[model samples]
Target chain A: MKKLFQIALGIIAAIGGFVDIGELVFDTQAGADFRFQLLWAVPVGVLGIVVFAEMTGRVAAVSGRPVFDVVRMRMGLNVGLITLAASLLINLITLAAEVGGAAIVLQLLFDLNVSTLILLSVVCLVLVVYFVPFGGIERIFGYLGCALLVYVAAAVHLKPNWHEVGQGFVPHLPSSALYAYFVIGVIGAALVPYEVYFYSSGAIEDRWGTADLNLNRANAALGFGLGGILSIALIVVAGEVFFDPHIQPGYLGTTALGAQQAFGEAGLVLALVGMLFAVGGAAVECAFSGAYTLAQFAGWEWGKYRRPRDASRFTMAWLIFFALAFVIVETGVDPVLLTEYAVILSVVALPLTYLPLLLIARDRTFMGDHANGILGNVLGWLYFVIILGVSLAAIPLMLITNGGSV
Target chain B: MEDKQMDLVYRVLDDQLVDIEGRRCGRVDDLEFDGSLGDPPRLYAILSGSGTWHRRLPRPLRKLGERIFGTGVSGRDVIRVPWEQVEEISSVIRLKAKARDLGLGQGDERDAALVAKLPKS
Candidate 1:
């Protein structure tokens, strides 16, 4: 029963922690525009993340070093510095978007000003980071964010045609540049670089070792698999309610309306609460990812398991990040637009973050008997090619489609 | 130990260094070697810290790094762990000495001191 509870907690955290402001925005937008045509991208992105995340967690558990540490060692100082700069920039933008996202959710729930809400959100996050243990933070946000599962129930209640939903899974390429843009956006949103950084570091924080290898695999598979289901649920709900209405879902409030359309007041409440926790959880993830990348690259003491005084530089990095994000959001940029830009930019930088993990994971010196198996190598290289292709095409498609406004 | 030979670049350089207590010191940023040009070089010392890392860059960037880190041309800031101090070489380089005791963590100590001064919430 104890082991079952542990697995259950891990899965819940992954599912709830999976959908952030970017996934919420892109999945709904994709559903609205393509009406389930782009659903194929969700699993592709989910599996891509799982493959690398498992490798990262395995490397951390077996080697006792996080992914970024391996990245610095493999890429060397100069190239690693370049990668670090790009990742930090993307993390900052993503963090700002998430803070803005949580603020918007609060504003929707309370009819409060967004600026005040942003300030409140930043304060709350800092306090939580300071006061709560890492495990506590994960469980609180994870369970609360499960409220988003309401989307799945709402999708089921709407009873869409089973044939069309199944057809959505078979990959079909639409000729429109806009469809291509959404495809890239949906995939990028699913496999954000920070997820691997956070997961690997989280493994270390949780004190995982060789014994936890199966736990890592199970967590990545079941947790992220369920996350894929939630993404698909968002797309399905949008298809049923917003497609015919021609709603673009340009706001968090608009995404919440899908729940209301399906189940009225109860759905609206659950959706808002779930979104608040999910986006709040993302804000924490991005902030810590930024800190972890910097600290691990510099070989500084890091991990939420350490006391604040012990990991001072790491703590300072995240605190400074949150303050900067609050300032950005206070400038009043639309959080949804920021989410789109962050996702696209991160996709462009994905190869730099992931390639090193693939290399080091396969290096027998690091893994001993636990190195990448035959299946791991096959899928790792396959995703490497796919990621490279998408990365090269991302900027051109975004430019051509004008951020999918076309 | 002398019979066990491995590629230093692949096995030693860039790997993390952990001290006797299992605390991370840093990565193997660079290395020092001894012997004449014609003879096979022997590992002499393990170089670490930002100074050594900065020196690995191209000339202009190395200058910029020196300016930012305030490292001098003599490279006094680099922490040199004598090769004999390495107790084991595996996934990570294990050092026989404590990192703090070796005067290798001045920057970290300073940061901790500053953070300690901040009021607890």
Candidate 2:
């Protein structure tokens, strides 16, 4: 029963932790613009995340080192420094966006000022990070985040033509640059670098070892798989409800109304609650990922599992990250807009992060008997190539589409 | 284990260095060798810290990194752990000595001091 509960909790965390401000914003925009035409991108992105996340988790469990550690080790100082600089910048932007996102949700619920809410969001996050145990943090946000499943219900309730929904799964070129931009956005948002950084480090935090390999695989598959389901549901909800009215959801409140449209007041309340926790959880993830990346790269003590006094540098890193993020959000940049830029830039930096993980996971000296096998290698290289293509094309696509505003 | 021969670049260089208590200390940013040209280069110490990494950078960036993270009075701002002190070489380089014992604790100490000034929970 204990084992079963662990697996179940892992899956829930993955699902709830998967969708952040980026996904909520971009997936909905994709639906509003292309009406499910980009649905294929979600699964493609999910598969890519699962493959690399599994490799990352395996490396952590077996070797007792997280992804960023391997990245710095395998890539050496010069190349590793470049990767760290890029990832850290993207992480800060993502952290700011998530804080801003949580603030927006609070505003939607209470009609509070955005600035006040942003400050409150940062304060709450600091308290949570400082006082809450790792497991407590995961359970509180991960379980509450399940409120987002309301989209699943909302998507089903709005029952559109089954044929059209199925057709969305077929890959096809978009008719315009804007549609193509959403395609890249959906994919980029799904496979953000921070997810891998957080997941692999979380494995080490949990004290996973060779015995936990099967658990790692199950967690990545079920957790991220359910996350993909939520992504698809968000797109479906937007396609069914927003497409008809030509309403583009540019705000967090607009996405919640999809729930209101389908399930009335109850749905709106749940949607807001869900967005609050999901985005809040993402803020924590991004802040921790930044600290983790820096600490790992610099070879400092890290992990919430360690006492604050024992891991002071790690503590300082995260606190500074939150403080900086709060300052950025306080500047009044739109949270959703920040999320768009962060995700696209993250897409451009994807290969720098994953390429080293791919190489290390296959190295016999590093992974020992747990090294990537025939199938893992084939899929790893294939996705490496695919991720490379997306990284190269992300900037061009974003430029041509003018941040997907075209 | 006596007959075991491993490639230094593959096994040691750039690997994470962990203390005996399983705490991470730093990475093997550069290696020091004691032997001359004709002699097989004998590993002397494992070097770590931003200074070591900075030294590895191309000439221009090296100067820039040095300016940002000042070089120590010794002119090499690195924590050098003698290779003899290494307990094992596997996925990570485990040292028999604690970080502070080897003077690798300066960074950790500075950061901890800063954190101690913050309001505690």
**CA-only RMSD, every prediction:** 1.9, 1.7
lDDT of 2 by residue, A312-404 (tens): 888988989999999999998998899999999999999998999999899886789999999999999999998998888888988998888
Q: Which candidate is the best by DockQ?
A: 2
The C-alpha local distance difference test score for the whole of candidate 1 amounts to 0.88
Itemize residue pairs with steric clashes in candidate 2. Answer: none
In order, what lDDT does every prediction score? 0.88, 0.88
Model 1 C-alpha lDDT per residue in residues A182-273, reported as the tens digit of each score: 99899999999988899999999999999999899999999988888999999999999899989889877899988998899999999999
User: How much is A344 displaced in model 1, in angstroms?
Assistant: 1.0
lDDT of 2 by residue, B5-113 (tens): 7777767888888898888888887888898879998889888877765677888887788887556333246787899989998778889988888777566677777
- CAPRI docking class of candidate 1: medium
